[model samples]
Target: MKFGIIGTGTVGTAIAVRLVEAGYQCLGVETRSARSYARFRQYLNRDRMPLESWVPEADLIFITTQDGMIGSAAKNLADRKLYKDGQIWIHCSGSQKAQILKEDPALPVKTLSMHPIQTFADVGEALKLLPGSHFGLEGEAVEEGIQIVWDLGGIPHRLDPEGKPLYHAGSVMASNYIVALADMAVQLFNLAGIPKEAALESLIPLMQGTLRNLEKVGLPQALTGPIARGDSEVVRSHLECIPLELQQAYRALGRSTLELAQAKMKLNGKEYPRQDLQILNYLLDGGKEKNNHGNCRENIRSKRNYC
Candidate 1:
């Protein structure tokens, strides 16, 4: 299949290079800025051309622009009557739906939104991580367009257009939120006088082990540590040691961990000795607190066999 890439950012260049390497013809790339055009040329080893020139030459076009620019770019292309009938136009924006491309009725393209569920810090690393990642696809042409995902060694999952924002939010929680949590961990380690690099190096093994446990055992079954053990003293100590700036985050995560532990049958009906429960209550009672006792008991009974 012949491919034309618009925007020429990291995602666009990475997909373009992968397509070329897989023996698909990459017709050309288009970008609005000189710097982006230069970067695209350097990464794809192809010259930048006008959108009008490139859009009509390929059977498929990828509009891998920033989320805000995608609609405008699509309109611009449609105004020029750039798309040929039967051509497929796909965007890599996780939060956008295929309907964005249908803004102009003059464009007879088969529109689809195909978002790779992986971070692309740069084109080089993105190319290496492309294979085996998930791609969320939405549009009428989904089945036909999914072949390109498979050709690129990716798994394609169908998503409802209405749920695009929610799907993208979940991805952000999984990918971006993890990074923020890691930063919090690093900050705690720094407070303990460990160098940033040393802290990260020390935590790598624990993080890997946790991920392995998740992969092997999954969710509540993989949960461990103080919360899982219902060790109120350790939990109290954690709350006491957390700085003011991080206290809220610690409490939020603790509540989540407590719920997970309860779901896993790790927390018994009797609160951790009164002193421990007192400390937990002090930490978690302030904001929208819910009665966890009944829910905890129900979860324990339901998953008793797992314990």
Candidate 2:
């Protein structure tokens, strides 16, 4: 299929590069800046062209602009009668529904949302990381979008348009929050008088190891550390050592981790000492623990009615 990308940012360049490699025709790129044209010259077909001129040349038109611009751009395209009956209009927004492009249900163009759930640090990183990445797809040409993902050597996951917000939230927690957590880890290392260069070197391997464990064992089985073992003293020691804000954050995360710990214990036919469990939960919730921790271990293991 002939595909023209409207934006020439990381995603746009990456998609165009992969599509061209996958034997898809590149109609042309439509961009405002000469720098972007200069930047992604290898991927863009022909040259930078007017949006109107570019729209008609492709079977698929990808509006890879910023989130705020997507709706306006799609509306402008529809208003100008630039889209044809059978042309597919797609965007790579993780949070937006396909309707952002097909605002006018009367328009004959098939609309879609095809978002790659991967971080793009740079064009080079995007080019390398996109393959085997998972994409969230929705709307009229979902199958076609899935084919494009497969052509890129990526995995495709279907999504309901109404659930895009929650789906995006999960992606944000997984990707963006992990970055924030990494920053926090660096901050802790900094407090210990460690240089960022040294700290990052030490920390990245630990993070990568956790990821490897995640892929290898999956879920509760992948979870480790003091929380998994229900070691109340260790958690309390960690809380005392960290700053107040980190302590709060630790408590919040530990609350969630406790559930996973319970699951792990059940799966392994193991039980945590009730006193140790109670102390940890009390620490997590500021002296409040959930639903009779004194009996939680036996309740979880014997009856399987986990607290």
Give the range of the ten consecutive residues with the poorest summed lDDT in model 1: 298-307
Q: Taking the tens digit of each residue's C-alpha lDDT, what string does model 2 give over 1-307?
A: 8889887889989988998899998877877767777889855546777778768768999999888899998888888988777899999999889989988888999989999999998889999999989999999999888888999989999999889999999999999999888888987776666877898889999999999999999998999999999888777656545655676777788999999999999999998899888898888886633332444334433534333
Model 1 alpha-carbon miss at residue 106, Å: 6.3
Report the alpha-carbon TM-score of model 1 versus the true structure.
Answer: 0.84
Candidate 1, pairs of clashing residues: none
Q: Going through the candidates in order, what is the number of backbone clashes in each?
A: 0, 0
Worst-scoring 10-residue span by lDDT in model 2:
288-297
RMSD of each: 8.9, 8.3
Q: How many residue pairs of model 1 clash at the backbone?
A: 0
Task: Evaluate residue 264 in candidate 1 and report its C-alpha lDDT on the 0 to 100 scale.
Answer: 78
